[model samples]
Target: MDETIAEALRIAEESFIASSGPGGQNVNKVATAVQLRLNVFALRLSPPVFGRLKTLAGTRMTSKGEIVLTARNYRTQEANRDDARGRMIQLLEAAHKEPKLRKKSRVNRIGKEKRIKAKKNRGTIKAGRGKVDW
Candidate 1:
């Protein structure tokens, strides 16, 4: 893992709660769901990365700038904890990538000609649909 991501994880807060889904009696008794909260602002990421992280987080990010992730797929608290950490790492890695700059591309002459030809053909078909004046 990257140092920054490691550092971010170091400061992240984690808690466990009872999962609502399967696992029979164990699910009813034990807290297997993990909730991980990370303060985005505290990560001190650059503006672009932070903006991307916020967008990627969507509703998971609270107004207070803390991202909350829950993992309940497993029946064990440790499994869920690992799952939550994995998800956080995935999110951070995604946000860490710099977006590719889109290059302005002009339509090639052949493509433009093909488009015009198609338009003319469609226009001819439409014109032929009119009632014959004969």
Candidate 2:
């Protein structure tokens, strides 16, 4: 576990609920679904990282700036809990990375000429397919 993510997890809140799916009587008896909520604004992330995190969270983020994640794929509560925590860690790690800056690329003269020539050839072919003016 990363220190940053671990620190975030320290403040995270978790709850368990009954999962809806096939699991015989055990599903009704056991609360396997884990819901993890983290307050993004509470974390000590920079503004850029926080902005990116909010974007990446999409609908998972609440108006209060909390990110909620649910995991119910497993039959056991521990597994589901681990799954949810793993997902949060992954999200945090992605948000931690700085996005690559895009460089402006210029088309060379030969490339420009080739593109123009291709466009002209395509136009000529299309023109030849039309009804003859004669």
RMSD of each: 2.3, 2.2
Runs with alpha carbons beyond 4 Å of true place in candidate 1 = 108-110, 125-134
Model 2: residue 70 alpha-carbon error in angstroms = 1.0
Candidate 2 lDDT score relative to the true structure: 0.91
Candidate 2, which segments miss by more than 4 Å at Cα?
Answer: 131-134
Question: What TM-score should be assigned to candidate 2?
Answer: 0.88
Candidate 2, residues 1-134, lDDT tens digits: the string is: 27769888999999999998767789999988999999987787888889889989999999999999999998898989999999999999999889999999999999999999999999999989987676
Q: RMSD of candidate 2 to the true fold?
A: 2.2
Location of the lowest summed lDDT over 10 successive residues in candidate 2: 1-10
Q: What is the C-alpha lDDT of each candidate?
A: 0.92, 0.91
